[model samples]
Target chain A: MTMKRLINLKRTEARRIFITYSAVVIAYVIFQVMSSSGFLSSSMRGMLVPICAYMVMAVSLNLVVGISGELSLGHAGFMSIGAFSGVASAILMQSTITNAPVRLALAMIVGAIFAAIAGFLIGIPVLRLKGDYLAIVTLAFGEIIKSILNNFYFGVDAQGLHFSMLTDTTRLLKGGRLIIRGPMGISGIMKIATFPMGFILVMISLMVVFNLVNSRSGRAFMAIRDDRIAAESIGLDITKYKMMAFVTSAALAGAAGALFAMNYSTIVANKFDFNTSILILVFVVLGGQGNMLGSIIAAAALTVLPEKLRGFSDYRMLLYAIILIVTMLGTNNAEIREFFTKLNPFRRKEEA
Target chain B: MTKRIFTCALLILAMSSCAFGAPFKLGGTAPLTGGAAIYGTAARNGAAIAVEEINAKGGDIQFELRYEDDTHDAEKAVNAYNALKDWGMQLSLGSVTSKPCEATAAENFSDRIFALTPSASSAAVTEGKDNVFQMCFVDPNQGTASAQYIGEKGFAKKVAVIWKNDDVYSKGVYDTFIEAAPKYGLNIVSDTTFADGNDTDFSVQLTDAKDKGAELVFLPMYYQPASLILAQAQAMGYAPKWFGIDGMDGILTMEGFDKSLAEGVMLLTPFNADAKDELTVKFVAKYKEKHGEIPNQFAADGYDCVYAYYQALTQAKANADMSAEELCTKMIEQFTTMTFNGVTGENVKWSANGEVTKDPKGMVIKNGAYVGLD
Candidate 1:
């Protein structure tokens, strides 16, 4: 497809975009109003928040896996670090620091930074590995993180060994007993997550990813995806650009994680598993690798689909796999592309 | 290409409908088919049963249950959180233990949604959480509940607590047992921790438990480990009463457990569906009628919570005289009297900490079935 034809596809694409954006906004507003109206139960109303967060995670991870052509199963590690940093910071603000929106913003930034550091740490050694090797490395990274978090002592000893699962909300100083209770988890967190907060943060993350993917850094990464040796032959910094993609992907995952903590009140170790990392990658793949809007749409759809199909309990996963396979087969087939080409009358005229 | 577009569009439209006005949406994250799949799948079934039961009761409310596969990972659960939050689900469920719940709390489950984990028993989930409303008890609560039962019965003066360090849930329970043992005046002379869950040759651990002057050894693990550890403990001639936790609830009914290895063993939980209680008879029959089998406590609690959400909404119905805040107050007020007469017993009330505090009926391993303990 020529640039002109592709650019012209924007017209039809614009309509799709409008439909999607409208659907999301309308659905979000409708749910919020209904929930606030006391029409639904507190638990059902509560599910909306996570659905939005997952959409963002799905979209951001897509930027790396889909756009940059790298399989990163370790993104959850960065997210975990980000969650602790963000939540710990937010906890500090609620307890010791002066409470303000700036505190949350700063905490989110720090949390993203923490996640970025993690991404860099992992990316430094393993971005060189491709395909299954890369997947295995990333998967191992996730497992290692789980082990560490399972064993993490978020508190210190007598030298002010800050302890307790209630990081800082609820009862800050309780009966001289600081429950650094390592495995217990960080509890008593503040829930500052409103739809507006989650919406804005997600928007920013989406925007950042969108903008980055269109930049020179993006092209380099895309080139790396096409042919790393060829791109490197032209003196493209494969190591740097790959690491860049890895770091940015981690940063977004971390930001989402931090926002997650900000929305909820506690943290546990089991929440970030290898399967989750793979699921995010699934979004990137299912969304049409390298397509931004595709990822967003996929994320939103997957989030709500399983819930709607909750009635098909055991068959739920079967449906998910089916959907993934069908979509992949449907899109990647040459016959389908040929059919579309034949349908488009403007296509043959271009060669003429 | 055309088909992909059509399919995607159709999916988009369908998903929006599910998100907009579905009733009783229970958002839960579990390791549906992973290492924790045994428990996770059962928990998923528990959730599925709850959804089925609620809808079957004349389809009471207009709520939907949105389940996100957390794969038991905390970070990915953040996505589950976002998905649940975006969909505006009321109550969140699933995640059998601390990891996902911890990830959930970290991801902000407390503010966005009222979480009631049917299986998570980590002490961290309840210690300070106001929004984490777990349907099940925490480690300390479950541990103490069991300890009190064991101690009250004067089960033994000396106890050997065998646990695996690799698993946080096991460790948390053991830690609580250790702390509560001193209170109960039980001498925990021998506490052995294993490295792997698959290590069936617990000769060293069993030997240690035996040497520690154990009258009973508390082994809290899954079916495979529990069976392996039990056989090893028996072969070692330890003969200490093999006391464990709910892990053995259903295992008692499983055939793999040698009857010789299982006699006189005690396990503890609040409710077992096999019990002959009035609630148990009805709930189990109803649940089995729908799901085609006996429901575990997880399934029962999930059913109760989902229905409870409907009940709460009905009571919370924006009162004509009251504002939204007043309506919430009314709902919260009405929720207090809410007694879910599920296959388990009543779980209608929420504690000050937002956790369900009603005790489950007791169970003990007899042959392999988790028979009700009198």
Candidate 2:
């Protein structure tokens, strides 16, 4: 009887994964149909890549904030780092690599690696703090990153890499081309990120977050989140699990950033400042801290909502605020809470 | 069932009315309600007045002006552009600012859509785009003109440059000025910079210029900061010949600004509100009547953009039932060769690359109002 129960539980877990994957695929196919058939407006169609990037950001942030139970206010900093690094790599590789897809893939990998390294370095010192302390440090880091980018000028050519800070003292090799010009930022970036590439990235981000949330390490993360002292006494390595979640989250955010950077011809550091970090946090919070699918839905809806409401013109922002408040209230109200409880896709057997 | 049928009939009638309207619809995106709303409001008012006058004349074509607020954001500007495009708008006056114009014009990769901006001076706004045009001079032209005018008049041999380091417009103009200064026999003695917003304390930079014996200070920023610099310089009793760009056009009328602070402040502008020409008199009076204030350079540019479009259409001999794509092609062909005298009181000509070739007039503030110097 015990063996059969374990087998049935495994089957349910597998079934749950199947359901989420199918849901994402169905939604994507439906969007493609609507876009091609002219049922969706061009404004809505233009938002496909941004929605995907924000979804990845929301889900990855859900890993650290929801499952691991840590608040990070500097997600945009990691994203900026990824954007600059990825764009730098893509610009450097463009002349040599003829194929656009391969270059984009390499750029994303570079972005993710650099962002993971930054997260590791930051997580070592910051993971020791908890609550508001961690939040403040992360916020400061975001500001610091933006200030640094504001002064950073970079180029690449025969010299391999040339850089300067707030001055034109750059020493370039022969035939070197300047890529970044401080506040003017990286212009003329090749637009290689399309809906299909963005869709693949969202899948990768969801896969990482979902699988990690179900693994043994994920249980330890939740234990620490529930009671830190109890988790420590139970012989769980608290920092190890926290760092794992944070670094993975940062890496996924980096990939999202790379996708975002390719969508624009010119991007500046101001585009990824403190407000952006707060915006992403709002997405994670409103989506339900631990809900991956909710984050995806919330991110996509919020990104497209303001654009669809642009006809109102003067009252666009006012209507946006009203919709946000109503949705938040509806999701948190007692009756709706009960409804959502019944619809929870990841509810365990005991909860059922 | 009867109620449902009634609702369905009403919806169908509403849809048909929208589909059958045959007005020449033009759309635009502007800041409308943000830090840059002053410019956006002025641009919209100018365009609105032009459309009203054009329609009132009862030509064969009736024009409609539709605009969406971008809030000075690039992404929002692109969103506005796409929304308008989806609604069957093919010709647009793109966003008011450089970044938003760049964003909106990127969507015009195919020549199927045409964009004409009023006040975005950045050269990148039309870079690599065949269908995009600007009504204002590019930054390099404006900057070079200022330098040449100052040099020829021998205003000052020792000049100092102060600009906003974080702004693309300020940087573009400042860099060109720096490159053109030596050619004009002016020495840039003290080159200093300040960050945008709330960094209003210019005492250090001013003292540096004063101590360096700088006779002129070139400010390539907007009027708000320029006002602060003037006030602070007065407090310090360090007065230099202040020169600014078109961004300084509204300084004399800034609320709470002492009129004396602008006594000798000179700027490069294409529009002279004091011009007594017939078009200038009529446009200024009409704009003042409509907006309760004198029209700024941006407003003048906006007014000119509409007339330029009308001229291009007329020259192309565009008629109803001309496909938007065909009309865009003809407009581009005609716009490249058309020249006109407009409300700005300058003879306007556009190059193939969409650069405007109207020379800016140098104006100075006297007794708290603009007086043309040349």
TM-score for chain B considered on its own, for each of the candidates: 0.81, 0.91
Deviating ranges (above 4 Å) for candidate 2: A1-19, A171-176, A234-238, A339-352, B1-21, B196-200, B235-237, B252-263
Q: How close is each model in CA RMSD to the real structure?
A: 10.2, 5.2
Q: TM-score of predicted model 1?
A: 0.69
**Range of the 10 consecutive residues with the lowest summed lDDT in candidate 2 chain A:** A1-10
Task: Write down the worst ten-residue block by lDDT for model 1 chain B.
Answer: B318-327
Docking class of 2: medium
DockQ for model 1 equals: 0.10
Best-fitting candidate, measured by lDDT? 2
- Candidate 1 wrong stretches, greater than 4 Å: A1-52, A55-68, A95-101, A128-131, A156-183, A194-238, A338-352, B1-138, B148-158, B164-172, B189-215, B221-225, B231-239, B254-261, B271-363, B370-374
CA shift at A143, candidate 1, in angstroms? 0.7
Spell out the clash pairs found in candidate 2: none
Candidate 2 C-alpha lDDT tens digits along A210-295 = 67877789889999999999999989999999999999999998888888888877777878888889888889988889888778
Question: Model 2 chain B, TM?
Answer: 0.91
